[model samples]
Target: MGTNICVTFFAFLCLIALSNAQTQFLRWCVISEAEQKKCQDLKKVAASMYANRVPSYEVIPLIECVLGKDVYNCMEKIQDNDADIMALDTGQAYFGGRYYNMMPFLAEKYSPGGAGTGTGDGMNYYAVIVAKRGSQFNVFQLQDKRACFPGVGTAAGWLYPIGEFVKKNGQTNIMQVTECNAIVKTATNFFKSMCLPGALTSFYNPFGNNPARICELCSGFLEKKCSTDDPFAGYDGAFKCMSEDAGDVAFLRHDTVAQMAMNSSYMPDNYELLCPNGMRVPVTDYMTCNYGSIPANTVMTSSLKTKPEVDVYKNFLLKAAQWFGPSGQYRNQFDMFSSQPWGYFNRRNLLFTDSTQTLVDVGEKNTYYSWVDNDFYQIMEYHNACPLITARLCVISKQEKKKCEKMMMAFNAKDLRPSLDCIKGKGTDDCMKLISKGDADMVMLDPGDVYLAGKKYGLEPFVVEDYGNMNASVHVVAVARKRDHYMTLFNLKKKRACLPGIGRGDGWIIPMNIFIETEQFIPQHCTLFENLGQLFIHSCIPGAMDKDYNPNQKPVSLCEGCAAGGFRKCQRTSEDQYFSSSGAFRCLTEKGGDIAFVKHLTVRGNTDGRRQSYWARNRRSDDYELMCKDGRRTHIDDWENCHLGQIPASAMVTAKYKSEQDRTIFWQLLNYGQQFFSSDIEGDFHLFDSGTWYNDLIFSDDAVRLMRLDKSMQDYRNYLGQDFINKVENLHKYTCVPVKPSKKSSSSHTSISLLLLAAIFILQLVV
Candidate 1:
């Protein structure tokens, strides 16, 4: 027993030693050959320090060097476990943390009194726009001028200054362009020429159509122009691009002016910083005239590392910085912040930036978002911009506006571009007018309103709500009891009819148009109300008898079959028992009506025990049959082919002047919103649900997704089809007439007309 216990203890000790051996060394990633050589030399120096028993060097782990193709490759190496640590700038650090889940452990401090000085945590610097001392431009007057940038996606070069420009001027002429790199397009249009390194690469210009002027200022030969290998490529190179008169302004770090001044003949006093508020100050005034304060470059590692493991790497870096830093004891052995010894003086920032004063622990601000300035971080979040323009959605009611606001927040949370804003209008007509006047960008509307908006307001439909069909349209069918075989379309001259409302698409317009097309009804002197009253013995067309709809005629038979009592009789509201699609269906089933005009879903939605209303309690969808246009009756399920007419689905309408790119972006916003907040997802908000109180707030409650219409079908007339358009036009041409009330009844009729208009306006609110 004693021997076994001793053997077990020995095995345990060996296992502990193996674990320590595995974790005692960290592999540092290097991008270039020069950086790799420097990394190898540093590793040898660290080994010698531990061998010589340098004071606290014993606690530091063994150093290893790992070669990577580039910064992005180094990030991949670290994430894939081939390497352990690498240095990254603020923008690269954000990409590392966001895409690769790497966490920042140490920060590069540039000066003794830099940001986060007192706490010895978090490193920060300022981004500045610099120009010659006496330039005729400010922040607002930069249009058509030449500009210089360090490289694409760098904090000081591209992210900070470009973000400030967008925030100030709202992205200028790029608002209507849709591209993978809208920022590049914006810069291309804003400046007459620029030297944005890597601006022509496939990663930044995926479409390869970026303007050549973006790279016209570059000094590299042939293929290397506008690339990282370009002669004008970093903070120093960007300064050279401006100093040599290649560019009018340069975007760089606050220290870049002074640092480059020491190496070149140009004096720092010759350059001035352009303030965001349009003021130009001396280079020394960077603190007051800078674009924004940004976080410093950081050493990052995989987030999968445990806290203790990260602490071990942290201690190793701290000891390396302490021993080999500028003021360290072994500075002569291995200068940690210098790159001139590696024979890469032209590419000064090799393994680490040459300007790094010392390395500091990032402490609690270890995450990329937490370490970066909040404004800079947010700007980086929307770095792609995608035309960074706001799309104003016009809503009819307060409830719809509130819902739109929530949708905007949800879309923003997911970083959907062309940010959304809500505009409240008095009604659907007001919303249409707002869109026509350019006060709003989009609004949702049914086919009836779609026609009105198209013909009168010059608006078009760009997106339609998909409710499980190809065109997202619903069939307007004439429904009747399956047992009523004698109630055919050919013999319905004196039959009782049911309809949703007077001018609604599925109810009145479609059926009335079909009657004229089939020659079942003929017009006589445009007296539609009198002709309809003569054809049908009784009808339940809600709003047909309202003074606002029939100003000169009050046909009693039109409201004879309606089920509502006293004050709600023949009203176009839910209070009237026979009002909308479901109400019209109920009128046919319970009230004395022969045929009900409604959409295909009305039967399935309110029958087969789906609806628990008293009138629809025991109804079944199979009990109803559709009256086909050929006078044949079929099951309600055959609505796709056996229908009176097919109306285009509800759609998102916008001004005809809106560019195709703007329409595409609007579709993208709604597509992304539905993906994240659709009814199937268990999120706080549902894109398709209008809650319990409203039927359709911003979109149809039955919408499964939003479908973008083809560019050919963007126009309302084309989308509604020529046949539908002609029918609607004929309905107005033959039946509609301007009426003048007789002088004997003008006063009483005007009062009654205003009251009825008020009631109809209230009824419209149900939308």
Candidate 2:
């Protein structure tokens, strides 16, 4: 028994020694010799970053997993768990994801023209067909032509040209056909000869056994050279093919020729673009002349990893990227892309994106169809086209869902560039929340709500509604009867004032901000809203239903002057006497309140015998006047120089994740609808709401054109004034706090009330 125990202990010690001897490193898969070399440098930098603690990038141990000779083998190693991760062009990423059970966890971000910052949509570059400047050939005359391609499945170099051909043929909206076999057959038959490195061994290859015609235009020798295994296979190889005059046309990524031209070995002026429209442009005009862009290179992993393991890998890669990217001091030592030695950067981006903050989860499918922009999806699916595309619009409104459906119908009826879909939400806030949660796409927002949606909900404004004037800002003014005793901003402090609503820009938010800024009301001294309520005495500010808007709820102050529930009180709609611009003006005329906070032109438009509304039909222009900042009163026409600061026009906001292509398409559709419908004012179909139909659906009728807002969410705060933004944010925080008593407090108060009732009963009996 003792001898047996000794033998088992000795065996355990041997196993421990064996485990210690085998070195376990985080394997990074590499496809080529150059990539293998980069892996070494990556290992060194990662070691340094891992050791340092200041800006820790440490997550996974570093090692090279170069067990494969090519991208296909590299992916195979990943699938078998022999390797961990690798970066591939978007096309190869799709291929790996489709057949090899791989998933993408990161995408490369590139700055075009070496700009300071890159846009999310700038991830992809253009693909072009370059030919000699004096060549007489155009896209139409390319039949039976000798062609040179960078690689078999390369996006900009190969798929783009083939996709363009398929687009011209008009096939499917399904994105990519499995293995690209159908298009490869078409290309082999169309071209008299071609040199597409890796094409012979690729899964998509059509002429597998026919070696003569397939390799006729190839440059390398024997079985070892002239294919993807050769060093000069990508942009460099295609350019070599062009220079040697081996092929009449070469398909390459945009700026490749220009970048090579910077080396003096190639002349930029010797080449031109062969456009799909049968027009030719200079090589420098690649932006307008080249084939549409392909998706950017993506970092992918094999399905061997579980969900949690994949997440850990993603986190590690993203951290490594931050430590070695453009923002890091180690950029001189490492890069995230292969644009090195081309005046772009010295090191290549091996495992991370160029500028994206984080990797988006394209999910387990990772297919080409998962790419946003259905137009591109369809084009790539059916005809293999790479034209610019748009996303489906997600509208946010329950009451206006039908109107949105109608708008969708109208948009589809005309076959507009982008289509619209309606997503129902209870209210504006709910809609903004839906956008934040990625359920809804976009909605038109007032200035105050724009602030809330942008700062509080992480939404961004894509379009600002225009009201004919180039200046999209409006004037907020204080209006009152000329005979009223209120002569200045200070004089109306304790007076009963009429405002549009609690959350509105012109009515309540803007006015309250002015009061706070001018020292009329100090938020710090107020208990809930008692200070403001006391200052205003018994003022009427419509839509102040919640305690957050009016904490002194028991006083029945703001609601006192409000019309009955059915007739409208401080609502934004026309039914309320103390609602919008016109409604606030009517509040003063009807003696509901003394002063009205509204837009500069509200009183002017409602009075002077030009008014058409039932309440303003008999009103005269001289009765109402504007209150100037300098304790002076002026006529409504002179409100230009005597009003609150400028207010931004209502804007359309969407989630930041919405692609640029989709935003452009949405803007185009809306702009087209506005222009087409506004042209025929009497037409049954109107883009905006009328007296009783489609009221406040999408945008206000006062808006003319939809303008793009250049300001970001932070920039919006600056545009709206930082002090005002801070106050509004503070107010929102205060309002969001539950004002109702806690359970304990309620119970204690209930017990005291019961005691008082018993005491009252006893006193009555004794009496």
Best by TM-score: 1
Q: Candidates' TM-scores?
A: 0.59, 0.44
Alpha-carbon runs more than 4 Å astray in model 2: 1-413, 485-487, 517-528, 537-540, 547-555, 564-578, 607-613, 616-620, 692-697, 711-715, 718-767
Per candidate, the number of residue pairs that clash is 0, 16
Model 2 CA RMSD to the hidden true structure, in angstroms: 28.7
lDDT of 1 by residue, 125-170 (tens): 7888999988788877888989999887788888888876655244
* lDDT for position 171 in model 1: 44
Every candidate's CA RMSD: 11.5, 28.7
Query: For model 1, how big is the CA root-mean-square deviation?
Result: 11.5
Clash tally for model 1: 0
Model 2 Cα lDDT, one tens digit per residue, 150-186: 7777777776667666553453322232212145555
Q: After superposition, how far is residue 196 of candidate 2 from its true place, in Å?
A: 35
